[model samples]
Structure formats: structure tokens, C-alpha cells
Target: MNITEKILARASGRQRVSPDDVVFANVDKVMVHDVSGPGVIKVFDKLKKQGINVDKLWDPTKVWVAEDHFVPSADKVSAENIVKLSNFTKNYGIEKHFKYGMGQYGICHTLSHEEALVLPGEVYVGGDSHTNTTGALGSFACGLGHTDVAYVLLNGKIWFKVPQTLYFKLNGKLPDHVMAKDFILKIIGDITTEGGAYKAMQFGGSGINEMSVESRLTLCNMTTEAGAKNGIVEPDQKVVDYLSSRGATNISLIKGDDDAEYEKIYEYEGSEMEPLIAKPFSPENISIVREAPSVELNKSYIGSCTGAKYEDLVAAAKILKGRTVKIRTEILPASISIYKRAMEDGLLKIFLDAGVTVGPPTCGACCGAHMGVLAKDEICISTTNRNFPGRMGHVDSQTYLSSPLVAAASAVTGKITDPRDLK
Candidate 1:
């Protein structure tokens, strides 16, 4: 079995496992956001009426909460939802709730790594589809629906049908102008949105080893766009170093067997990779940055768990530094911690000097509601994972998803522009 299988087998207390094997794996960590928290509460309400024990979580210490989407109390409904989540966490004694307007809150997926909330060889589950993002830490992380999450909260375990692993090998290091986002976009294009459904997508090879931990997280984060069950990379020294910096010390790495099996193996030459973008309406509708459609872009959004990491902000700052954006641009860090780091490193100043709005670390803007959203007929080049119609605002508005460099470059030109093409 591959790394994914190995982790699942261990978490399930099995000596060995394979694709399609059903097992109830004990969960090490679980998360819920404001939206899902409320949904889970509703599930609990139903469960309570059904005479199931819904009065307490299996382990409050193992449960965490994040207030990302619908944050800043987007509307009256959102405000009420946050209140419900706060009460739920308090009642359950879950101390890891990262609330908005509080000291260290941001997107849930971003928090998974920044706060060292999840570790390698664990079975972590969250209520958001991007829960797979934490697999970068070598955990068997995946997302679950509201009822499924409520079940995990009460039972401390959930059943999963083992997913076949798809191994993506990067043969060489990515060029300075390229990013993990480009590579993932290229993969989504090749596999299409439905290709990885119910499958584990594991990244490896020389290029992945050469990439930074945050870059590897970006690669795994977008695996959801390919409809994958999870995305993971083998834990390494970099993973340990990263978690240590975040104050996590009890780090144990996990790796697959020498002859680990995979459902299929795909290889790519990272040196030959270039910046790529996914056009509106589908993550699989991709094109190289230089080959993107010529159109007036109304906005350049560089924020989201997928693209608003510290390194991503630095990459955007490098492009926006002395170059004023030709169109409106927004830079929202993925978390307050990253926001502070960006400010401390002078990245925020560069963005402001470049005439971009540096906003709070909120997913509202990236998810396309209650923040700066696109107007009808407007087109945006964003550093986000998905680009479905109305993903950002008006149902008629269009979005093109790209790496931070490409988005910042296109912001300067008011058109789809590659970072390498910038003067």
C-alpha cells in the first residue's frame, strides 16, 4: 500500500488495507467552521430527537473550530450562525475555536498548518471540502458532510472506503517563475474534475522534495478540484521544521513502503512547467498563462486558503512591488498570523504601494459573497482554487484562477498576463 493506504490502515487499526476496503478509522483531529458548525448542530438536534447521545463530543480537546466563511458576520444569518458555533464550542469545552475578530483567526484550512493543529499519520477530518489541505502534513485528512461530522464528533471515528492512490511524480524542481498552483492547475486539466473522484492523490519526487512546505500544501489543497478523496505528501524534515516553528514538537514522520502500490503513476517534468490558469465555470478548463484569453479584468483577488499563504503573499508582493495595478486588486492573507508576517516583512507595504487593497483574512472575499465581489459582466483573475460561475459575486461574472504571480501580473496589465511577460 502507498502512504495514503498505510495511514488509513494504521488509523483503522488494521495491519494492511487496500482500495475499496471499508474501515472505521479513529479520528485524531476534527474541525468545523461557522457554516458547518451550525450544520452539525442541526444534525445533533436531529440526533437528540432520535434518542442518540448528542449531549457531548467524544473528546472536546480533539475538536477544533474555525470561523472563516460568513465571517465578519456577513449578514444577520451569518451573525446568528457564529453565535451558535461559539455556544457549541463553549458548551463542549472545545478550546481551539479560532473565532473572527479574535486574536489569531483565519481560514480553517490555513489554521490546520499554521497552528500545528494536525500532525502526520493522523486521521483528520473537517467539515469543509478543503480539509484535504492538511494532508500536506502527511495526515490522512479528508472532508465530511454535516451528519458525518456530527457522527465523528459523537463516536470519535468514521467509516471510509479506502481510496485508490494516484501518484503524481514531479521529476525536477519548478522554475522561479512557476508555482505549485500552476502544476495543480495543469493536473486538473489533464485529469478533469471527475478524474480523481474517490481516489487519493499523493504527490512526490524530486520536484516535490525541492518545494517548500507551503507550496506542497497548495498542491494538495486543490486536489479537491479534481474530486479527490484526499491529497497528501510524504512527511519529511521540512514538515517537522515547519510544525516546530509553529510550536509543535512531538512530530513523528510517516512514509510508505519501498514497494508501495498505487492505482496509477503519473510523472511530470517540473522544469518544463509554466504558469497555468483555469477559466471560469470549471477548474479543469485550463490554459497556460501566456495563452489566456485577452480581456479586461475587473479585479485581481489574491486571497484564500489555497493561495493566501505567507509565501503566496510574498510572491504577489514581488510582482506588485513597484508596479501599480491597472485594475482593482485585493490581498487578504489566509490568517492573521500570515497577515502579521506579511506586514513585518514589508509585503503589505508593497501591496499598498502597488495600489492594492490589503484586507482582513476572510474567506468571504474568496468565496464570492459579503465582501468585495465581482459585478455583472466583470472578469477577475484570482489566486483561488475554483472558478465556477458566480463563485465570486454576480452570477454573470467570470473568474480566471491562476497563481499569485500570474494574478498580480495580470492586475498590472488589466488583462491575462504571465509573470514572465511582465516588463
Candidate 2:
């Protein structure tokens, strides 16, 4: 078994096991953001009113709550919701509570690692589908629906069907224009939207060693899009270096035995992949923008939990150092910490000089509510997940998902174009 399998096996109280075995596993941590926790709280209340012991749900110390989607209160309704969420946190006494405007809050997944709440080799669950982001630290993490989260919170354990393991071995060296995001888009293109359902994916290859930890995180963060239960890469020195920089050192390091069994294996040479994007309505609907026809964009965004890392910011700044963003484009950092680091490194000044709107480190545009929303017939090139029609606030609006460099180049060009083709 690999690290993920080993961790899951231990948590399931089994010495060794194969896939497809249903197991009752204790959840190590549970996370909820303001956007989803409110609904989960409502369900918990209903369960309590029906004479169910809500306290019997998960332990309070194991829950992490953050105000991310509507931080600083975007509007009256949102403000009221924050108050309600605050009340819930107080009532539960959850130690991992991150309040709004604290400058310590960002998207839940990013902030969880920042606050040192995620520990490697543990099974964690969150109310958001992107909860799989935690797996970057070598943990078995997945997203659950409100009802599922509520049940876990009540019982501290949930029944899970063991997932098959798929090994993706990457070969060759990646091109400068191609990145982990591009590689993932390529994988999704091959597998389609629901390709890896109920399967845990293990990524390792010659090319993986060349990718930075932040870049690897970007790749693993989107494993959920592949319909994967979880995604993992072997914890190498890069992993140790990254955690050490973040003041984290204690992590369970496990690797698959050389003779460990795997259900499926695929090999790929990522050297030739160009910058790719997933069109609206389907993550599998992918195309290399350079070869695709031009599409006018109403806005372009260059930040998200996936795209707001230091290297991501550096890439965008390098591309936009002396250029100006189109009037409709915007960019935001992942969190205040990231913003501070960028400013200290002079990257934020470059972005400001380029005329890009640098909002707070909150999830500004990703939520489609408080930030750069779209109008009718508009199309946005964004780095966020899910580009369904109306995702950015207009039902008729369309969103194109791409990397920060692609989004930055598109914002400057006022159209969807590849960064390599620019200037």
C-alpha cells in the first residue's frame, strides 16, 4: 500500500487491505466554510429538534470553521449569515474558528494549512467539494455533502467504500509554457468528467520530480475534478521543504511498497502539452487556447486557491510587469499572508503598475457574488473551478478556466489567447 492507502488502512483499523472493502473509519478532522456550514448547521438543528443528540456528532475540537465566501460581509444578507455562523461557532466552541476581517481568513482550504490545522496521514473531511486539497499534505481527504458532513459530525465516523487505486506515471520534462495545471487539464481531457469516480489517484513520474511543491499542490488540488476520491504524490524532500517553510514539520511519511498492487496504470510524457483550458459546462471539455478560435472576454481573473501561490503570482507579474490589464480584468491574492509575501518580494507593485485590481486576500471573484461579476452575454476567463453558465453571477455569462499566465495574457490582450503567443 502507498502512503494514502497505508493511512486509510490504519484509520480503518486494518493492518493491510485491498480495494472495494467497506470500512468504518474515524475522521481526524472536519472543515466547513461559511458558505456551506450554514446549511449544515440547519440540518444539524433539524436533527436535534427530532430528538437526535447533535453532540453525539463529531467532537468540537475536530471541526474547523472559516469565514471565506463572504468575508467582510459583502452585503446585508451575507452579514446576517456571518452573525448566524458566528453564533454556531460559539455554541460549538470549535477551536479552529477563523472570523471575518481578521486578515487571517481566506478560502477554507488555503487557510486550513496556514493555520496548521491539517496534519498529514490523517483522514479529513470538509463540506466543500474541493476538500480534496488537503491531500497535498499526504492526508486522505475528500469533500462531502451537507447531509453527509452532518452525519459525520454527529458520529465522528462514517462508512466508506474503499476505492480502487490508479497509478499515473509521468515521463519526460515539462515545457516552460506548460504547468501542472495544464497537465491536469490534459489528464481530464483524456479521462472525461467522471473518469476516476470512486478511485484514489497516485501521481509519480520523472516530471513530477521537476515540479515544485506549490505546483504539485495546484495539480492535486483539482483531483476532485477528475471525480477522484483523493489524490496523492509521494512525499519527497520538496514536501518536507514546503512544510518546514510553513512552520509545519510533523507529518507521517509513507510510500507505497515496490510490490504494492495497483488496479490501473497510465504513462504520459507532458513535454508537449500547451496551455489548456476547460470550457464551461464540463471539466472534460478542454482545448489548447492557441489552436482554438478566438473568444472575446468580458473579464479575466488570475487568482484562486489554485492560482494564488507565490510562484503563480510571480509568473503573472513576470508576464504583466510593464503591461496593463484590460479594463474588465481583475486579480486577487489567496490570503493576506500571500499578499504580504508578494509585496515584500515586489510582485504586488508590478501587478499594481500593470493596472490590475488587487483585492483583499479573500475569495473575491470565485464566489461570483461580491467581486468582479459578469453581465449578460459576457464571457470571463478565470482560474476558478466550475465555469457553468451564470457561475460568475449572470446566467447568460460564460466562464473559461485557465492558468494564471493564460488569464493574465488574455486580460492584457482582451481576448482568450495563449501567453506564449503574446508580444
Candidate 3:
């Protein structure tokens, strides 16, 4: 069995399982954010009124809540939602809540890793689709709808149809100018957005082993753009060390069986890859940096669970060190802790000196909720997960997705310029 099947089987108390098999598995963790938590709480209330009383969550400690989607509240409604979430967490005894304006608050996925809430070989679920980002820790993490989340809260179990696994064998090392974002963009280009729907995308081989935990998280984070059920990488010493530094102990590591079944296998030579970009409107509409047309941008943004890690910001700061941005640009750290670290490291100073606005740690502009919403006909370059129409604001506004290196370089040049070209 593959890692996914093995984890599911163990959670379901079954000796073995196969693709498409329905199983009721115990959930080790459940995460809900302000955007989705209100809906879940509403459902829980509805259930109670129907005589299906759920006095409390299955395990309050195992459930985590974060107010991120519209932190600082973009509107009255957003504020009310946070209040609802706060009341629910307080009443339900959910001690793991990261409330708005709290020192520990951050994008849920980023905090989940920093807090070590999701561990290897565990079955976890979140209200947001990007929950798969946690799989970088070697956990079986995926997203569920609000109602589904409510069900898990009530019963501590959820049902799933096992997904077939697609193996990605990456080899060799990427160039200094290239990044996991470029590599993932290339994969989405090859497979198209819907290629891996209802399937598990398992990454392995020499290239993955050589990448840092941050880079690995970036890779797994975007698998949702390919419509995958989940994306995972086997845990190694690097992951164990990262978790340990965050106070995690007694971790359970799981690996794919040597004879694990896979629906298909794709191989790539990382050395041959270059910085790439996903053109306006679709993550799969990819083009090599040098080959892409000259596109002038009205704005550039570098932040999100997908691209706002410490390493990613450091890469951008290196390029923006003594330069000033030609267009409007914003840099937001994914978490409060990351923001503080960047400040101590002088990365935030570099960004400010470069004329980039450093904002609070919120989903903010990434989800078009606030901070940096786009105007009609505006063009922006961003280091974010999606480029769907109207994703960042107005329906006519366009967003091109790229690595932080590309985003920073383009901001300096005010055009779609390759980072290597600056060298």
C-alpha cells in the first residue's frame, strides 16, 4: 500500500484498503478559519436545534481555529463573523484558537506547521482547500466543506473514498534563480489544472530530498491548483528536525511501500528547468520566464501561505536590496512570528527601502479580502496560489502568478522580467 492507503487503513482500523474504497477514518486534527468557521458553527447550531445535540467538539484540543481570512475585519460582516468564531471557541472550550489581533495569529496553514499541530502519519482535515499544504510534514491532510467539518467535530470521524496515487519522480538540483514555485508551475503546465482531480499526488526522488522543508511546503501547497485530493512527501530527517525545533516529539514517520501502487508516474530533471510563470487567469497557463511576453504590471504582491515563508522573503530581499520598485508593491509575511524574524534579519527594512509596503500577517490581498484589492483593468504580479478570474478583486483585473524572485524582479523593472536577467 502507498502512504495514503496505509494512513487511511490505520485510521479506519482496517488491515488494508484500496483506491475508491469508502472508509470512515478517525481525524487527528481539524482546522477551521474565520471564513469557514462561521458556516460550520451555523451548521452545528442547526444540528442542535434538530435534537442532534453536540455539546462540544469531539476533542477541543484536537481542533484548531484561526482568524485569518479578513483579519482586522474588512467590513462589519467580517467583524461579526470573527465574533461568532470567538464565541464558539470560548463556549466549546477550544483552547487552540488563534484569534484576530492575537500575537500568535497567522494564516492557519502556516501556523499549523509552526505550531506542529499536524504530524507525520496522521489524518488531518481543514476547512480551507489549501489544507494539503500540511502534507509536507508527511501527514494525510486534506480539505473538507463546512458541513463536513461540522460532522467531524460532532463524531471525530469522516468518510473518504481512497484516491489513486500519482507518483512524481524529480531528479537533480534546481538553479539558484529557480524555485519550487517554478517547478510546480511547470508541473501544472504539463498536467493541466484538472489532471489530478480526486487523486493523491505523491512526490519523491533525489530532487525532493535535496529541497528544504520550506520549498517542499511550497510544492505541496499548490497541488490544490491541480485539483488533487491531497499532495504529500515522505518525511525525512529534515522534516523531523524542523518539527523537533518546534517542540514536537515522538513523531511517527511513514513512507510509501516499495511496491506501492500508483496510477501513473511522471519524471523530471530539475537541472533542465528554469524560472517559470503562470500567465494571467490560469495556474496551468505556464511559460518560461524568458519566453513570456513583456507584461507591465500595476502592482506586485509577495505574500500568502504559498509564498511568504522566511526563505522566500529572503530571496526577494536579496534582489530588492538596493533597488526601488517601479510599480506599487506589497510584502506581507505569512505569520506574526515570520514577520518578527524578518524584521530581526533586516528583510523588512530592505522591503521598505525598496518602496514595498510591508503589511500585517493576514490573508489580506492574497484572497482579495482587503489590503490590496485590484481595480478594473489593473494588472498585478503575485506570489500566490491562484490566478483565477476576479481572484484578487475586479472581474477585469488580471493577476499573473510567479515565484517571489520573479515578483520582486518584475516590480523593480515594472514588467514581467526574469530574475536571472537582472544578473
Collision count for each candidate, in order: 0, 5, 0
Tell me, by lDDT, which candidate is best.
1
Better of 1 and 2 by TM-score: 1
Predictions in order: lDDT: 0.93, 0.80, 0.92
- Summarize candidate 2's per-residue lDDT along 138-215 as a digit string, tens digits: 778889999888988888888788788888788977788777788888888888768888888778888887888777
**Residue pair clashes in candidate 3:** none
RMSD of each: 0.7, 1.7, 0.9
| 1-423: candidate 1 lDDT, tens digit per residue | 788889889988999999999998999999999888999999998888988888788999999999999888889999999989889999999999998787999999999999999999999999999999999999999999999999999999999999999999999999999999999999999999998999999999999999999999999999999999999999999999999999997899989999999989999998899999999899999998777788889999999999999999999988988999999999999999999999899999999999999888889667886579988999999999888879899999999999999999999999999898999
Q: Arrange candidates by TM-score, descending.
A: 1, 3, 2
- What TM-score does candidate 3 get on C-alpha atoms? 0.99
TM-score per candidate? 0.99, 0.95, 0.99
Supply candidate 3's per-residue lDDT for 244: 91
